[model samples]
Target: MHVFLPDGKQLDLQQGATALDAARAIGPRLAQDALAATANGDLVDLMTPLPDGARITLITKKNPGEAAAVFRHSLGHVMSQAVGEFYRAKGHPADAVKRGVGPSIENGWYQDFDLPEPLREEDLPEIERIMREILSRNLDFSRREVSKAEALAQFGGDPYKAELIRELPDDEPITFYTQGDYTDLCRGPHFPRTGALPGAFKLMSTSGAYWRGNEKNPILQRIYGVAFATQKELDEYLHRLEEAKKRDHRKLGRELELFVIDPLVGKGLPMWLPNGTILREELTRFLREQQFARGYQGVVTPNIGNLELYKTSGHYQNYSDSNFSPITVDDEQYMLKPMNCPHHVRIYASKPRSYRDLPVRLAEFGTVYRYEQSGELNGLTRVRGFTQDDAHLFCRPDQLKAEFLNVLDLTVLVLRTFGMNDVRFRVGTRDPENTKYVGAEDNWNAAERQIIEAVEEVGLPYSIEPGDAAFYGPKLDFVVRDVLGREWQLGTIQVDYNLPERFDISYVGEDGADHRPIMIHRAPFGSLERFVGILIEHYGGDFPLWLAPRQVAIIPIADRHNEYAYALEAELRAAGLRTEVDDSSNRMNAKVRAAELSKIPVMLIVGDKEQEGRQVSVRERTPEGHKERKGVAFDDLKAELLERYRTRA
Candidate 1:
């Protein structure tokens, strides 16, 4: 067997040799340092056997993108072993601790176990100690494949493992990896030896999770752990975790009075508080202005539509699982709309005739509903009901690229307005092998090519992701990195031929014939709820002047100055600024502290001297504490704030 390296070097090795052997053949240091390998761009464990003429790139700690998953996954196995050992040491039989599936997730790994005793948060330390002890043994991880019958027999007592084996396809290999006394059913590319793992791993927490995420199944105690290739990286990640905790949207939402998820209202349903509603309104106003200027005609649609409407648009058949159950009123079935495009399509179909109206841009701040699982719901980010900044452009084929470019321009403007300037793009195309997509092959190819060309022309950085396209179309998603360097998918523009075909929507062409118009679905702010959540975390609850729920807080130094503070608040509000006056009996310092904690961008301190001068002392709340910019004329302050608000600074 032969394998090729990036440098075009080839090595002839024994048949069935793994990537580890290939690395060793290149250099002993490379073999020892290698964490994983990319075999033809597909990530593989160092233990994965290389095929003849395969291209392999050794993934060391330096390539954290690929190496992190391998490291974390191997750590999951170690944690599972440690958990089992901890239980056995506590007097439970070795086999009494039944292991469920354990897999690596983003930034970490988690393993589920059906144990004799429930795992507590306090047990993490002992589990970590056991993991370290196991690491010290330097035990080799040996892999083996077994038949279904053998695997079922081996794990018969563990119903979870037995069920998994029974469900697996006959052609799929049932594999397991063993390290000393610990063996687990897994198809893995693991570290050759226990010592190959870095010591920079920690058991984070534990929680109850159903086996295979099915509520009907037996609940298992799941332990989560995060690992990194180096201690510095681990420290940095932990620091970020701490920062994330401080910026968690749920916490900020409550403390800042942004939004609330009331179980009484329903799970996964969020109601925006006054402050959060201001955020939503301001964002909507900004985008609405942009869309209006770009020739988008705003439209209002109902929250529910006839079930037949979705069936005609293919949403009923394709997205039934995500949609709430149908409501039958007077023998007529209606559904809470999971999307706004179909309604917009109906509006387009209402009155449309000429080629001149080829690019009919219809926009809406439409709220949509989806049946999200309870466990999956988190604050406003993942909700059952949310509003989308949605728009659909029915354009002629020739106008598709230009319309897409315009939509992209609006999306970029919106992102930059919120200070999410670091952007990446992904052109999501249909998987050639996936039959789930509804469009014709040629249409899919054309839509994918159109998006790619537009992205290329705009000179935006992007990658192609196969199988990520919506069932109806190929889409381009804008992935933006916030201030904290975390990426969020904020906006999308999709091209669809399927929807037009399914709905039979058309416009009279220049040739005096009916022609199907390509539908371009776009959401500059994917969902107002999710976008606000991300924005809260990105800005650490300190929004920009234009978007700030309360732009200014006027604090009176004394009861005598309360009237003056109110006057200043009125002036600021009249100038289109969101302002509030602290008229409570609290001390000035306490008022300032409260304002700062509320993340008010500007604090105006009103006192006797300021009242006489018709000026206000300004204190700006920064990432650091408030910076005092002593007395400025009220007129001047208002002018500066108005300018900043106008420019969205």
Candidate 2:
């Protein structure tokens, strides 16, 4: 047999040679460091046999990004072994602890266990100690293929493991890895030995998770641990975690009184308070102005639509999972609108159009509903009911690229305005093997090509992602990294020929014959709720002058200054600033403290001297510290603030 390396060099080997054998044949250093290997892009353990003519790439510690999964899986097994050992030292039976499953996740790994006693947080340190001891032993890992019957017999005392083995597909391989006296049922691509695992790992936390995420199944204690190739990386990740804790939107949402997800209102439905509503309105107003300038007409749609409408758009057939169950009224099934495009499509079809009105751009701040599982719901980021800054453009084939570029421009402007400048693009195309996608093969290809060409024309960098497309057509998704270096999928622009065809929508061509129009669906602010949540964390609640919920807070030092403070508030409000007067009976210092805590952009202090001087004491918040200017003329203050608001500084 001959196997190829990444560089296309071939090496003759004996039949059924494993990756470890190939590595040894290539070089001794590679063989010694080979943690795992990928045969034709599939990661596999060293013991797995390499197929003839397969392309093999051995992974080592130097390739941390790719090798993290291998070592992380080994860590999970080690953690589970340590747990069993810890319990055994306490004189429990060897089979007293039952393991469910442990898998490598992004940045870490987690293991679920059915323990003899509830594992407490305090026990983590001891578990870590045992894990270190085990790692010190340099136990070599060995894997073996087993029959379903043999696997079940080995784990018979552990019902979780037994249940898992029974559920395995007949064609799927049943394999187990053993290190020292501990063996686990897992199909693994793990580090070669315990000593090969990275020392930069920590047990972060634990929680109760229902077995396999099913509430009806028995609950298991889940322990989470994060690992890195080096201690520096681990330290950096830990720092980011701390920073993320401080920027948690849920906590700030409560303290800032921005939005509320009340239990009485049901889960995943967040009600925007006055402050949060202001944020939404300002964002909507900004986007609307941009759209208007670009010839987009605002349109309104209903919250619920006839099921037949979605059925016509292929959403009912292909995207029914996220959709709420239909409501039956008078023998007609109506669904909470899962998408705004279907309604917008009807609007375009309601009346005749021509090449003269080729690009009919319709925009809406449409509220949509999805039946997200309760456990999947988070604050505003993952909500059932949310508003999309959605729009659809129906244009001729020639105008498709131009219109897409226009949308791309708007999305970039919106993101940059919010200080999310670290942006990347992903062109999501259909997965050939996925049957869930609905559309003619030619239509999907055309739509995907149009998006790619438009993105290329703009000279923006992007990557192609398969299986990330919408059911109806291909899309371009924007991923932006926030201040904390966390990435979010924000804006999206999708090109679709399928929906227009499904809806039977067309426009008169230059020759006066009916021709199908291409649809460009875009939502720059994916959703108001999710965008606002990210914005909160990005800015740490210190919004800019234009977007701040309360831009100016006027503090009156004495009772006599109340009138002056009210007058200042009036003038600020008249100048299009969000202003408030703090005349509540609190002390002047307390008022200043309150303003600072609220993250207000500016605080104006008024007193007898300021009133007599026809000026105000200005204190403005900045990244460095508060900048204070005493006795600034009212006109000067107003002019300076208005300029900032106008530029959205």
Candidate 3:
């Protein structure tokens, strides 16, 4: 048998040789250093038998992407062992702890256990100590394949593991890795030894999760831990998690009075408060103005449509699970609009278009609904009801590139406006093997190629992510790095060839024949709700002057100055600045503190001296701190405020 290396060099070996054997054949040094191997891009343990003619890439600590995953899985095993030890020391039997699945996740790993006693938050530190002790012993991990009957018998007392073994195919080889005093069932790639793992892991927290995430199943205590190749990386990640907590949008949403999710209204349905509403409307107005300037005509669409309408567009078939169940209207089914493209398609087909109207760009702030699981709901980010800054353009093949570029430019502008200027592009192409994706291979290829060409023409960096495409088409996604160094997938522009064809929409070409027009779907904000949620976290609820709901606070120093403050508020309101007059019986300091707490960008203090002089003692919030200008004329202050709002400074 022969296996190929990444450089195309071949190594001849026994037919049943493992990756570790291949590594030894290559060199003793590689065999010693290799933590895991990737057989044709699939990560496998060194002990896993390699198929003849397989292409293998040995992973070491330097290969953080693969190495971290291997060690992370090993860490989960170590943690599981430690949990058993921690329990046994408390007089519980060895098999007292029932196990569930433990898998490596992004930046970490987690294992679920059905414990006789619930694991508390305080138990994490003690578990950490045990985990370190296990790692210190440097236990060698050895794997063995077992027959189905034997595997089932070994885990028969544990229903979770036994059920998993029973579900495996007859031909599937069941394997378990033993390290020190513990063994568990797992599909390989894990570290060769506990010492191979870096001292850069920490047990983060514990939570109750149902076995297999199904509500009807028994609950298990899931412990989450994050691992990295180096201590520095681990430290940095922990710091980011800390910063993330500080910037959590849910916390800020409540503190800033932005939005609320009332149970009576329904889970995942957030009603925007006055301040949140202002923020949303401002964004909508900004995007609308930009779209209008770019020849995009605004249109309104219904919140729900007939089920057949979605069936025609393929959303009903492709995305029915994510979408809400259809509502019955007059004994006919009506679906809450899961997407705005289908409605826009009908609008395009309503009018017979010619080559002269080659590019028909229709824009909408259309509200759409999805059936999000209750547990998956997170503030405004994951919601059942949200409005998308959605638009669809139907254009002739010749104009497709220009139209796509125009939408891309608009998306970039939106990102830039929000200080998410550190942008990266991801081109999501269809996965050929995925039956869920709809459309011809040729159309998918063409759509993908056009998006790639446009991104290249703009001279930006991008990556091609397979299986990230919309079911109907390939898409260009914008991943923006916010102020905290966390990346969010924000805006998207998809070039769709399937939907137009499915809808049978056509335009008269110059040759006097009808031709199917290419369709482009774009949403710079993605959704107003989610974008604002990110914005709330990105800005830490201190929005820019233009976007701030309460741009100015007018605080009268004393009761006698209330008239002046009210007049100033009216003036600022008339000038398009959002202002609130702090006219309560509270003292001037209390009023100022209240204004600051509300995150108003500006505070105007009026008193006898200012009222008599027709001026304001301005206190403006800046990154540097509160800046004060005494007795600035009302005209000058108004001009400065207006300029900042105009320029979005």
Candidate 4:
């Protein structure tokens, strides 16, 4: 048998050879660096035996695939060893602590442990000391392939390990990784020695997480740590973290008075303040006008809908776990809707349609609720209840591709309007092995084909992500990158083949036959709350000229100029701009500072000279200085503001 190497070299080998064996056959140097293998496109361990013919890509430290997973999984074991040693050194038994699953995730890894006592922030330093000492030991590593019974015996005294071992499939290898005296039940291929791992590990935070992410499960202390290939990488990541903290929308929101999340009102609900509400309303108005111009009709839907509506849309079937519990009315049940598609579908079905009316776009600012975990709740990014700038397009099969491009164009316009030009697209398709998705294979294939053509014909830069699609359809997600370089999932466009079939939605074709109308569910701003949060951080709470809640704030220097300030405010308001006047006897400089702190785009000052001349002094919000007075004609200033508002930039 032969296997094609990454460099297109063919290596003749036995009919059944493992990746590890293949690596050893190549060279000793390659064997030392080999971590795992990518058979075709799937990630698999080196221990797994290969078939007769295959395309094999060897994974090493340079490849962040199977190698990274093995490395991080081994690191979790190291962490557990450190904790156990720390407890033993304190004359405490290891069995007193409860251990949970430790998995390697993006960036680094985290492990959950139910400690005898709560771990303090100060304890991380000591824990790091122990971890470094173990790393310095340079322990030799080995893997053991054993039976389920043998694996259970190896970890029986350790309840968590035993539980994990019990869950392993009978066909699986049931392997273990061990370094020195420390061992863990893990699937491999990890580095040959502990010394191979880079010495740039740091414990970042300690938080409570449920065991296996179930709220009913025991609460465990989840210690998150980040590791890098070099000290420079670690330092740069730490700096990014600091920058992220500085750009935290929750902190900036409070400081800028943009929005508020009060605990008394419960978690995950954001109450937009006066200034923040202005921002929300402005965004809604902009989107509404855009939809109106794009052949869309805006409709209003209730905050909650009957549970049956969700059942018909398959939300009850696919997303029941994430949705809020039903609001039962006697024998009947109602659910706080988790999505806007159902209501929009009802609106589409409310009227008769034909192939001539191929596409009908229904838009709404739909608010929905989810059952987010309390611990996962943040100010606005991860909220239980939020508004979505949602729209659903019901169109004939022939019109699907064109309608998709239209939605894509609208989404691009929405993002570009606010200067959010740094964004990437993810084309989410179904997982081949996942049976939970709702569509028939033919319909799914047709919808996915049209979407791929639409996105590609428009020349979009995107990656096709398997298993990331909504249960009902293949979708495209618009991901925004903020100032801090954090990616935020904002808008989404889904081509749903399942919902239309499930709801039995149809239209009269030109052939005088009843046929299914393909549904395209889209939300330019996936969640208005999350979008606003990302936008705040992206701009550092300094909104664009059009989106600024307080477009202009007028300040009167003295009682004599108060009338002039009022007059200036009226002039601005009459020009269709939002304006406010600070008539209090506060210092003019102080008023200006307040306006700047609130991130107001413009400030109008009225003093003795301005009041007499009937001209208001204008100071724009610029980085260099605040008192950058560039007095212009009041009418001219109005025209510039109107231009910015109209352009939405």
Candidate 5:
């Protein structure tokens, strides 16, 4: 048999030869390091024999990042073995511990377990010791495919494993992995041996996780561990986690008085504080100005609509659970809008005609509500009620490409205005099996093709992701990474054909006939509330001069200088900067420290010398050592700040 490798070379092999065998045949050294193989572009255990004439690529330790998830998955089993051993050493029977499914997640792995006694964070060290011992033993991992009944018999007394087996599709084969005396149910592509756990693995923490991620299921203790092929990589990842923790939006939002999530107000409902409101209003103002400049017509729509409105848009069937329960007002059942599109569609349907009106762009800072689970809520990023800076463009089929290109230009401009340069875009397409999509195959293909061309024309790097599409459409999601390298999904441009077809929306064409319009739904700033929260952390609350909630704070060295501070504040405010006078009795050091802590972008000092000299000392919120003590002409500073604001920086 011959299989073409990812590099396009064909390799001749014996019948049923696996990728592992192919690697070994290629070179002796390659055989020694081969961790697993991607057979036909699917990651599979080395032990699994390949189908005849399959594409093969052996993943190894050197480029282990691709196989990291698989590696962490195997390490999970290694941890389970160590935990069982630890339990035995204490004279407790291993059977008392029950295991749940453990899967690999980004940067780490976690496994749930029902233990006789709850594990403590302090107990992790001893568990680590046993894990190290098993790693040093260097046991070879062995795998077996068993019959469904045989698999059930193997885990007969283990309900978690048995339930897992019972839940799998009847046609799916059951497989088990064994290393030393420990056996686990898994479909694995392990490190080939236990020694892969060498120095780079550690049990980080434990949390309560429900079985299969459902709150109604039994709660099990989930122990999380991060693994890498080398210690340096592990250290770097750990350090990054620490930095992310400090800048986590949930933590920073509270400390900065940006937003509040009150349990009494219901989960995922965030009330913007005064400062947070200021941020939201500024972002809205910026987006409205930018949208108007880009030829978008601002549209106003109610927050609730007749239930049939969503049914026509295909969201009721797909997203009804996420939307708030419908409100019954007399004879009509209205739903709190879960999306802005349904309303925009109604607007487009109100009255429309002609190819000249083809690319009508409607923009709005529309507030929508969704019932996100409490556990899933995280600050402003994931929330129940939020506003989307949304717009929908209705265009002719032939104009799709140009409309997409214009949107790309607008998206990049918006991102640059916010200083978000590390952007990643993923083009999301359909899941054919689901059968919920309303468009024809050709229309979906055309939308995807137009987006691909526009994305390419912009010369931006992107990836295509399947199964992430809207049921009515395909979309391009723009994600931005913050200072700590944590990526946040911020903007989106969706090509929707299903909605227009379902709504029977059409406009007059050049041929004097009605033609269906292709809808392009977009929001460069996905949500003003969420974007501001991310921006706070991305800029570490030290917003660029124009966007800062309080752009400049006036500081007085002593009580005698208070008058000048007030004068400076009034002058800056009148000149169009958000300015404040700090007339507190605290000393200069305390005042300056407070301003710095609050992340005020600029501080204007009005001491007796500066006041009498008719000048103000300016201190930027950059590092202290980078300070410049010179005063700018009052009018000059104001003009510069206004320019920055006008630019939406």
Candidate 6:
């Protein structure tokens, strides 16, 4: 057999050789350090036999993508074994603890367990100690294949493992990994030895989860742990976790009076408070102005539509799981619109168009509904109903590229305005083998090619992601990283030819013949609710002057200064500023503290000197040092505030 390296070097090996054998043949030092191997871009265990002519990239600890997952998954297995040992030391049977599925997640790993006795938070430290003791032994991980009946006989008393084996197909290989008398059924790509795992790992927390995420199944205790290649990396990650806790949107939302999700109303349904509504309205106005300047016309659509409309759009067949159930009234079925494109399609078809009317851009801040599961609901980020800054462009084939570039320009501008300038693009295309998509092969290829060309022309950084496209078309998703190094998919622009064809929408061409138009669907701010949630966390509740709900707060030193403060507020409001006066009986310093806690961008203090000079003391909130400008003219202050709002500073 022959194997190829990443650099195109080939090696001849024995017929039954594995990645470990190849690594040893390359060099002793390489074999000692190698954690796993990627055969033809697929990560595999070192012990797994390699096929002829396979391209192999030996993964080390420096390779975080595959190596980190392998290390973390091995850590999970070690933790589970430690749990069993701890139970046996306490005079319980070794088999007293039953294990469920355990897998490596983004930065850590977790395992589910059905214990004979309840586990508490204090038990974590003991489990860690046992894991370290086991690591000191430096045990080797050995893999073996067995028949389904033999595997069932070994774990038959443990219902969870037995049930899993029973569900596997007869032809599929049944594999198990064993290390120092502890074994588990897994499809593993793990480190060669237990000592290969680093000591920079810790148990985070525990939570209750149903078996396989089904509500009717028994609840199991899930333990989570995070690991890294070095102690420095672990410390840095822990610091970031602390920062994230302080900036949690749900906590800040309540403290800032932004929005509320009440179970009394319904789960996953959020209603914006007055302060949050101001944020929503300001964002809408900003985008609306930009769209208007870009030749997009505003259009309105109903919240519900006939079921037949979605059937024509192919959304009913692909997205019915996420959509709310249909409503039947007098033998006519209607659905709460899950998306705006289908409704917009009907609008384009309502009247006759021509090449002169080609590239008709229709825009709306449309609200949509989806029946998200109860467990998946979070703060505003995941909701049952939300509004999208949606638009659709109907254009000729020749105009498709220009229209796409225009939308891309608008999306970048919107993101930069919100201080989310660190952006990347992903061109999501259809999976070649998936039958779930509804479109011709040529149409999919054309749409995907156009998206790639647009991104390339703009010279933006992007990657191609297969199986991430919508059923009808290919899309370019804008992923932005925030202040805390967290990524959010905030905007999207999709190209479609299937919807127009399904609805048979066409326009008259210059030759007086009907021609099908291509549709470009876009939402610069993917959803108002989710965008606001990200913004809240990104800014840490301290919004910029232009987007702040309350632009100015006026505090009176005493009752005597109330009149002047109210007069100042009136003048500021007249100058197109959002202003508020603190008329409560609290002291001057207390009012200042309250305004600071609320994250008001500007604070004005009124007193005797200000009354005599007809001026106010202004203090601006900034991330850096704070300074006060004493005795500034009220007119100048109003002008400055208005200018900032106008320029979106």
Best candidate, TM-score-wise?
A: 6
Kindly list the per-residue Cα lDDT of model 1 for residues 1-649, writing each as its tens digit: 8989999988899999988898889899988877788888777876667778998888875665557777788889988889888988899989989988888898789998888989889889999999999999998888888888889889998888988899999988789889998888998878777887889999898899988888898888888899887889889989888989999999999998988888899998899899999988988988888988999999999999999999998899998789899999999999998999999998999986699877899999999999988778988899999999999999899898889999999899888877788999998989889888996889988999999999999899899999999999999999998766688898999999999999998899888899999999999899999999999999888887788888999999999999898888888888788899999999998998898788889999989899999988999977666688877999998999999888777
Per-residue C-alpha lDDT of model 2 across residues 524-638, encoded as one tens digit per residue? 9999999999999998898888999999999999999999999988888988999999998999999999999899989999999999998999999986788999989999889
Which tens-of-lDDT digit does each residue in 20-131 have in candidate 3?
9998998999888888888988888888889889999988767755567788999999999999999999999999999999999999999999997999999999999999
Q: Model 6's lDDT to the true fold?
A: 0.92
lDDT of 4 by residue, 85-201 (tens): 887788788676667878877767898887878888798888888888887888866777899998988778876778788888988878877888777777665655676666777
Worst 10 residues of 5 by lDDT: 623-632
Quality of model 5 by C-alpha lDDT:
0.83
lDDT for each candidate structure: 0.89, 0.92, 0.91, 0.82, 0.83, 0.92
Give the per-residue Cα lDDT of candidate 4 at 579. 93
RMSD of each: 2.3, 2.4, 2.9, 3.8, 2.5, 2.1
Residue 206, model 5: lDDT of 97
Which pairs of residues have clashing backbones in candidate 3?
Answer: none
lDDT of 3 at 280: 91
lDDT of 2: 0.92
Q: State the lDDT at 64 in candidate 4.
A: 41
Give the winner by lDDT: 1 or 3.
3
Superposed by TM-score, candidate 6 places the C-alpha of residue 393 at a distance from the truth, in angstroms, of 1.0
Error of 1 at 513 (Å): 2.3
Task: List model 5 lDDT by residue over 314-351, tens digit each.
Answer: 78888877978888999899998899998888888998
lDDT of 6 at 586: 96
